[model samples]
Target: EAGVVQSPRYKIIEKKQPVAFWCNPISGHNTLYWYRQNLGQGPELLIRYENEEAVDDSQLPKDRFSAERLKGVDSTLKIQPAELGDSAVYLCASSQLGAGGYNEQFFGPGTRLTVL
Candidate 1:
């Protein structure tokens, strides 16, 4: 059984430094997603993609954060000039439409980012 893959399990960067995280979802999953988990809070949706099209990204901060799911297989999330408030666990998830019109999401061990 294949699972989601993410890189750089942990990262420490100075404020104003650029950072990027990569993720490869399970094969055949059509929906890819990115989320931010702040300390002591549930994960918040940042962006979501459906077969290479960004279906929703209203929560993403356009000025410094960006994401892409090219060909809808692999995805990447980037933060330019990271800020202290941006420190959190960036989660990557994917899912396929199943019976009953529900999508069961599989999550990867998030990449923990710490901005000082």
Candidate 2:
């Protein structure tokens, strides 16, 4: 009975402070994704990985954000100099069907970060 795990369900940081989030996906699942949800908006895909390979990350902000999935299992996302606009939900999800599991992503409750 394992689900997507995320630490620090809530975080508080200054506008220019650095913050990071961690995630552990369900065992045996090969695909992982990180999404950002703005208030009153749908989750936006920030990055997607397949077996340690980042398949898509075009929407990720390379300047201030970074992500990695070393073993394609657990992953982490970091934000350097977090901005007030970065205050949102950072969701992590994964599924057994990596190639065809478009709708199989099991999302976590998300880490709600507040930047001042």
Candidate 3:
């Protein structure tokens, strides 16, 4: 089966510009997460959603970052006034809650952003 898909594998933009990334998760996966992976570091969770509701977004920078999974399928993450520090790989992952509480996430190729 096909896994998650993300658009614009790479993007380069000037600092302070607005940017957006899109993701389409595997079919029937109800849980989704957005993560940011910096150079030489593991991905950090930015937001999480169960169905169409955002269940966790405490790590997301509300001041400049926002995300939505309106239909619990495709999701979009946006950053306004992007800063140089925002340069990183934005990843989208999805998983299904299975028996015995097993949930293994499958990640997309990710959108690499470079803020110059």
TM-score of 3: 0.95
Deviation in Å, model 3, residue 90 alpha carbon: 0.5
**How do the candidates rank by lDDT, highest first?**
3, 1, 2
In candidate 3, what are the lDDT values of residues 1-110, reduced to their tens digit?
Answer: 99999998999999999999999999999888899999999999999888888888999999999998887799999999899999999999999943213798999999
lDDT by residue for model 1 (20-111), tens: 99999999998888999999999999988888888889999999999988877999999998999999999998999432137788999999
Q: List the candidate 2 regions with Cα displacement exceeding 4 Å.
A: 99-103
Q: What TM-score does candidate 2 get on C-alpha atoms?
A: 0.95
Q: Mark the 10 consecutive residues where model 1 has the least summed lDDT.
A: 96-105
What is the Cα-based TM-score of model 1?
0.94
Better of 1 and 3 by lDDT: 3
What does candidate 2's lDDT look like per residue over 26-107, in tens digits?
8988888999999999999999988899889999999999998887788999999899999999999887755534557789
Alpha-carbon lDDT, every model: 0.91, 0.91, 0.92
Q: What is the lDDT of residue 110 in candidate 3?
A: 96
